[model samples]
Every structure is written in C-alpha cells, then in structure tokens.
Target: MGTAAVSIEHLGYRYPRQSNIFTDLNLQIEAGERFGIFGPNGAGKTTLMHCMTGLLSFQQGKLSLFGNDIATNKKETNKLFGFVPQDFSFYQELSPVQNLEFFGAWCGLNKQAIKQRTTELLEILGLADVRNKQVQKFSGGMKRRVNLAIGVIHDPRILFLDEPTVGVDIQTRNAIINYLKELNKSGTTLIYTSHQLSEAEELCNKIALIEAGEIIAHNTLDNLLSEHKEDGLEGLYLNLTGKAYRDGNV
Candidate 1:
C-alpha cells in the first residue's frame, strides 16, 4: 500500500463557548482509500474536517497531509486536497462552463487547459448538454453534479466532501453516489461524512463512527461487522450511538 494520504495524531478542538468537541483523535487514511465518517449532529464530524484541511487552527496535536505538516506547510497541504462543501454556492447567472473557467483560472490553470478540462469534466459528470445553461435554471441534481465537477477540475489527489447529497431526490442521490464511486475507482482518495448509513455501506471501505465529540469506533466494514456481529452499519451505529435525542439550541 502507498503512504497514508492523511494522518492525525492526538488531535483536539474546542470552541470558546463550548467544551472540547474532539479529544485525542487519531486516524490514518491510506492512499486510494474510500473512508467514511459517520456521526450524529454535533459529534464534531465537520470540525474534524476543518482541522484536516487546516481551516480551523488547534493548539494541540499534529495533522499531516500527504506527509507534509498541515499547520506548518499550509500552502503545500492545501494544494494536495480538493474540498466540496455541503452547501455549494456559485454564480447564479453564470453558466457551468463560465463558473468552471473562473475557478480553473484561480487554480492557476491556463486558458486552454481550463477550457479543455471543463469540457471533459462536464461530459464525465453527464452535464455536457447543460454546460451552457445558467445554473439558476438547473435542477438540484444537476447543480450537485456541476459542483462536483468544479471540485475535481484541478485533479487533486485527495477529495473531501461533507454531506454532498443532503437534500436531493433518490435518483439524483444515486447518480451522485455512482459518480463518486467512479472517481474512487479511478484513483482519487475520498474522505466524506454522511448521515446515510446505507450509502456509506455501499461506498466506504473503512468507516469511523463518532459521537458526542469522540470516535467510538473505527475499522473496515467487514471487521466492524465481525466485531459487533451485526448485519448492517445501521445496527452498529444505533448500538454505539443510541437513539436518544441530541437536541441543541441556537
């Protein structure tokens, strides 16, 4: 196996008003691995992602991306990852091609390269016909596909997606998941957090079950099943996380 694409050691985080969200978290994701992070709301799933991408600064612990320290080598670490946020926003008036061109330029790709890559990505994501249509006119599924294409246009080695299919129709969700599987098969390391246990079962080779700001379990799907002697991930999740309400006040 190749070197670990992401390594976290004794990582911890906290907000000024809230106590520590994650404590003493250690994880290593190998290259080309499709890893899933499953957690209830407020379990620090997104917080951990921020720390991994160097978006949030933590005083304690170490984080490395592709062997480079994320804290000390921010630029190099960021360049090695592509982030697809849950709530993807783009210019409503611009077409898919235009939006991709702008982001591609920002990534330092030349005009010709940007155009070629945009065309290829749109086609691959089944957005070729709508490439010229304004994003505001597209359906939710189309928009998600466009968002994914933009994220992968630069071809980074690692991809981070936080709930990429939160509120969409079943067909759209399936399409998005299928595309993600293709990306993984083609050698892009994927790390994502999802509430959909069934989808995670289908796509993730390894999973981390986190709750109450701590990781309760982390292992391959087969091992997790064998250890728990459960039939599915949902059973294991409920067994570990419980069914109690985790209500929060804003």
Candidate 2:
C-alpha cells in the first residue's frame, strides 16, 4: 500500500447542544486513493470534514495530514490539502479567471503559473467562454466548476470535497467527476462526501459509511457489498442507518 496522505485515529467530537458527533473514528487514506463518505442527512459528515481540516476542535483522537499532526500544526497541515465545500462562496462581482487569479495569489503562486493554470482549468472545466463573465451571472453548475478550480489551483496532495455535485447538472457532474478521476490518477488522494450512491460507486475505490457521527462500515466497495450481501451502496446504507426520519433543525 502507498503511504497515507491523511490519517484519523480515535477521533471524537461533540457540539455544546448536540450529542457526540463522532467517536473512536479511525481511517487512513493512502496517496492516489479515491475514497467516498456516505451517510444520511444528519450523519455529521460535514462536521467530520471540519474536524479533519482543524476548523473545529475535537475532544479526542489524532488527525494527521501529510504525516504532521493537525492539532499541533494546523496551519502547515492544512496547506497539504485542498478543500471544496458544499456551498460555492466567491466574489460574485469577479470573473472566473479573476477569482482564480486572486485565490492562486493567496496560495502564493507566481503570476505566470497562476495565469497558465487558470487557462488550463477553465478549459478543462468547459468554462472557457465564461471565464471573463462575472460569477454573479453564472448558473449553479458554472459556479460549482469555478469552486472546484479554486480548490485545486494550488495542487495540494490531498483533496476534500463535501457534496461537490449537489447542485450541478448531469453534464457538469460528469465533467467534474472525470476531472477528479484524472487528478487521482495523477497522484492526488481524494476524500469526498456524497449522497449520490451511483456516483460514489463509480468514482470511489473505497467507502466509509457514517451515521450519527460514527463509522458504521469502512471497506472497498466490493468487500462492503459482499459482506453485507447487499445489491449496492444505497441498499447497504438503508440497512445500516435505517430509513427513520431524521428531521431536525439545521
């Protein structure tokens, strides 16, 4: 197996008003691996991502990014990963190229490299025409593509994506997935959360099912199916987490 790009051991977290979100969660993702996180709406997937990124503190467990403990060196550790959040938040008035340029600058990329990468990313994401258009006027799919480009501009070794295709169209979704696959093939490790089981099945080599802040299952896709004797991820998810209503105020 390749070296681990990210590692989490005995991770536990809780919110003041909320119950424990995660407990004794242990996971390791190796370089060039594509892993998916699946769970119900209230399964604490986002919370786990926050904890991994060191945006939120956890009571126990250790999280390491690129072999450095996140708790002790959060700033340096965070630099080893790229994050694409569920929501696309950017300067609405800025064009796609301009936004990428600004973020690349913040990431400390040289002007020539930023310009070249921006061009390549825009073309790859099929946003070439809209590269100069203001983000405020773009569609949801377009905005999501731009969000992805920004996340990967610095080319971090590992990537974290939270429901990346949530609001995108089928065409854009496929495009994004293909690009991510290419990145993985080129040595980038990916960890993402998704509600789309089919997408997860096609893109993820392994999966971790989280429910009520705990990992109910973790293994390769085929192993999970064989162990549970389930037809697919959706069936496995229902069997593990159940179909009970999880209605709660967000």
Candidate 3:
C-alpha cells in the first residue's frame, strides 16, 4: 500500500476540567485519497485536525505523516501539509498580495520565490482584480478565497480544511471547489470536514464518520452507500447519528 499520508493510533485527548474528548482513537488516510471526516457538533472533527496540524498537543498515542511523527519532526512535518481553517485566518488589514507575501515568508519562502508564487496564486484564486484592496473590506466569499490562497501558497502535499467553503455564495463556493479538484487531480491528498454533504460527496471518495471523537464508520463512498443503502451521505449520517438534537458547540 502507499505510505499513509496521515496515521493516528491509540490517540487520546482531553480539556482541562472536562471529560476526555478522545480515547484510543485510530485512523489512517492513504496517499492521494480525498478523505472526508464527518461528525455532528462536539464530535471532535476539528479537534482531530488541530492535533494533526500540531495546533494542539496530545498526551497519548501517535500521529504521523509520511511515517514521521508530527510531535518529533515538528517543522519538517508541518511543511508537508496546508490548512484552511473555518474562520478567516489571514490579516484583515493587509491586501491579498501583502498577506500572501507575509505568510509566504513565514512558510520560509525567499524573496523571489515568494513573489513569484504570490503572483501565481492570486491569479489562480481570482484575487488579481483586487489584490491590492485591504482584505477587511472584501465580502465573506472574497476573504475566504484569500484565506485559501494563503493556505496553499507553498503547494503542500496534503491539504487539511475545516469547512473551507462555509458561509460563501454559491458562485464562490463553486470556484473554490473547482480549484481544489484541479489541485487534487495533480496529486495533493485532501483531508476535509464540512456540513455540506452534497459538496463532500462530489469531491471525496473515502469517508470516516466520527462521533464523540471515535470513528464509527469508515469506507469509500460507494461502499458506505451500499452498506447502508441510505439516500446519500446525509441520509447515512442521520441514520448513524440518529435524530436527537446535537449542540455541536459543546
């Protein structure tokens, strides 16, 4: 099998003064697979991403990328993936170009290389028209695009997105999804979580349904559909999660 793009074994986590979030969680994403992680609120979907990206530290178990432990390799392993969080992660006061330049430098790109990559990304993300406008003035969709551009400036091999297309117009959403499709076609493995099941169905071939920090079901889209025979991802999701109210923020 191809080297695992992401691997987690016996992983566990908890917050101060609260109950444990994960206990002995295990998961693996193969290279070149567009893997989708799904769960209701409080399911630990975002938490898992944070742990994978080194945003949060776990006291137990192992998390690795390309066989290198993230906790051990730190900087080197970080360079292998990109992240676009659910919230806007760029400097709102800076223009798209300025933000890209600053973040590109943070990613360790040199002057010429940073400048070159910035130009290319701005063009590709359709931000060239307003590259100089301060990001704070842009619409939600526009800002989301800028966030995506900054996230991929270095062209990471594996991209992790937490609701990357949330709160955007349909047109903007389509633009972002299409761009991501092209990127994945070029061989970037994707790890994503989103509420838009239809959108996820369009892009992801493999999926893992998580609840309370544990994976309850994992398989390719076809297999999942065949096994449950639900109408779609949403149907399967509701079937697995049930009809009870979920305060995901908890």
Candidate 4:
C-alpha cells in the first residue's frame, strides 16, 4: 500500500493557561487528493492546519508526512510540504520577482533556477507585467497570487493552504481555483481550509467538517452528503455542527 499524504494520530493541542483547543484528533489524507477542512469561525480549522504544517507545536500524538514522523524528522518533513497562510506571507515592499528570489533561495534554489521559476510563476499567475513592481501597489487578487507563488516555489509534494482566495473578485478567485486544480492534477496533495463552501464543493473531493476543534464529520463529499441526507456541504455542515455562535478566535 502507498503511504498516506498526511496522517494524524491522537493529535492534541492547547496553549498555556488556556483550555484544550482540540484533543485526540485523527485523520488520514491520501496522496493526490483535493481535501478540504471546513468549519465555523474559531473552530480550530486554522490551528489544525498550523499543527500539520509545523507552524504551531502540538502537545500530544503524532503527525507524519508520507510515513515520516514530523516531530522526529522535522527537517526532512519540512521539505515535503509548503504552507500558504491566510495572511500575506511576503514582503509587501518587494516586487514579485524579488519575493520569489528570496523565497526560492530560502528553499535552496540557485540563481538560475530561481530566475527560471520566477519568470514561470509570473507569467502563469498573470503577474508578468508587474514582475518588477512592488507588491504593495498591486490589487488584492494580485497580492494573493504572489502569496501562492511563494508557497509553491519549491514544488512541494503537499500544499497546505489557509484561505488562499480570501477577499478577491470572482474572476481572480476563478483564476486561482483553476491554477490549484491544475496543481492537484499534477499530483500535489492539497490540504485547504476556507469559509467558501461553494468553492470547497468545487475543489475538494473529500471534506472534513470541524466544530469546537473536533472533527465531527469526515468523508468523501458525495458520501457525506448521502450518509447525512444533505444536499451539499452547507446542509451537512449545519446539520452536524449546529447554528450556534462559535465565539472563538483560534
């Protein structure tokens, strides 16, 4: 059998002086799957992604990437995935080319490789005209594209995206979604979290619904809808997690 793309076993996490955010969470995502993690605001969806990407440390259990222990082989595992956080993760003052150069270097790409990759991403993401322009002057959609380009510079096997297309026009959103679909088609395992249920339905083959830091539902989108007798992700989400205010900022 092939190794799972992401494996979480009895995963637990909490911050100091705070109650447990989540405990005993277990999930397995297979390679080449477009997987979505959906939940209400403050439901620990971002926190779970952070843990998986090694941005935040967990207090218990195991996280593995393709069968390698992340805790034990942090360096090795780090090279296997890329994380595109919800926030702008690049230097706004820098040009897209500059940001890619810096990030590509950080990922161990040499001068020639960085130059080639930077050009490819600029053209592919529609940033070729503004390749040398500072990112701060670009529109929200352009900035989002830059952020995504930086994340995948090294072409990691797994990509962890947190709200990769937040606050953009429908056209830009569609462009990003199409690019992501092509990436997934090329065999990159995607672990994504977003409030866009309709977008999630369009992108993800499997879905996991979380509330209060726990996974309440996990299955293929079709199976989840069928088993719960719901028509779509929204119905399944509300049916499983309720309509109460979350009151969480995690």
TM-score of 2: 0.95
lDDT of 4: 0.92
Better of 2 and 4 by lDDT: 4
lDDT of each: 0.87, 0.89, 0.92, 0.92
Off by over 4 Å in 4: none
Query: Which ten-residue region of model 1 has the weakest summed lDDT?
Result: 241-250
- Candidate 1, residue 5: CA error in Å? 0.7
How far does residue 124 in candidate 3 sit from its true spot (Å)?
A: 1.3
Model 3, 1-250: lDDT tens digits are: 8789999999999877778899899999998899999998889998999999999999899999989899899999989999999999988999999998998888888989888988888898889999999999999999999999988998889999999999999999999999998989888999999999999999899999999888999999999988999869999999998879889653
lDDT, candidate 4, 1-250, per-residue tens? 5899999999999978898988899999999999999988888898899889887889999999999898888888998998898999999999999999999998888999999989988899999999999999999999999999999998889999999999999999999999999999999999999989999999999999888888888989999999999998898888998888877754
C-alpha root-mean-square deviation, each candidate: 1.5, 1.4, 1.0, 1.1
Q: Against the hidden true structure, what lDDT does model 2 obtain?
A: 0.89
Give, for candidate 2, the lowest lDDT window spanning 10 residues. Answer: 241-250
Arrange candidates by TM-score, descending. 3, 4, 2, 1
- Work out the TM-score per prediction: 0.95, 0.95, 0.98, 0.97
Clashing pairs in 3: 41-248
